[model samples]
Target: MKTLLLALLLLPIAAIGDDSRQLVKLPPAAQESLRQEMLDNLVAVNEVLTLMAEGKVKEAGEAAETKLGMAAMGKHRGKPVDARPGPHMPPAMHGIGMDGHRAVSEFAAVAKTGDRDKALALLPNLTSACVGCHFSYRTR
Candidate 1:
């Protein structure tokens, strides 16, 4: 049983694979902006995890909502200017980013309710998006 649970827990990470090389080069300013965004995301994820560890599930969810949620990003960054995909971001890649944002939103909702089991269950799935995105895209 323990083995099965552990395997399930690891499944998402395992599926991420090792393909996360940076695939595109951006202008220096864009590259630095993206790097900072990634770092901020890392901090948010770490904060949520720490809150969860401390048994503050709802608080963790709030952190996710405020830090990594789609609405939050949209609010801070403004709505995307172009409906068409950008130069480096193809339609498929953009779709992946959208999906990742949605996953983060979903995780935040689950966490907000203080459902520890469900939140724990979704953590790996949530992180898989990050792994998949990093593996699939990068800036030079």
Candidate 2:
């Protein structure tokens, strides 16, 4: 009964649709590709955190660079050529994407130094790009 009431209350808002964010229109293939990349990024970040927790900071750094850093750029990760989404993104959005890659690269450098605390401190700088991009735009 309470769930039904909650759904009824939220229905109006759902009908309104969330329009505050900028929509990034892409072809269906590109959409799927970008979505997969984003999911991979999340996993990469998780591995970074988990490795750090396990006291393998250098390994974590390596994983971050390999999976999320600048070296990871231009890798459509087996997506079809038509599914490459970067060129379709708005300039600002593309810039944010690059910033995210650069952030992980910077983090990788610090993490490679084996100074766990310092590397961990830099994580927010790395993730802020992701947060900003997600908040600013939506592919849907």
- lDDT winner: 2
Weakest 10 consecutive residues of candidate 1 by summed lDDT: 76-85
What's the TM-score of every candidate structure? 0.73, 0.82
Candidate 1: C-alpha lDDT? 0.67
Clashing pairs in 1: 20-135
**Candidate 2 colliding pairs:** none
Residues 73-94, model 1: lDDT tens digits: 5432442333212334655555
Question: For model 2, how does the per-residue alpha-carbon lDDT over 1-140 read when each residue is reduced to its tens digit?
Answer: 23223333444454465565669899888888888888998898888889989999899899999999999999875667678898788987787778778878989999999999999888775576676676667888
Looking at candidate 2, the ten consecutive residues that score lowest on lDDT are 1-10
**Candidate 2 Cα RMSD (Å):** 9.5
TM-score between candidate 1 and the true structure: 0.73
What is the C-alpha local distance difference test score of each model?
0.67, 0.79
| Number of clashes found in candidate 1 | 1
> Clash number for model 2?
0
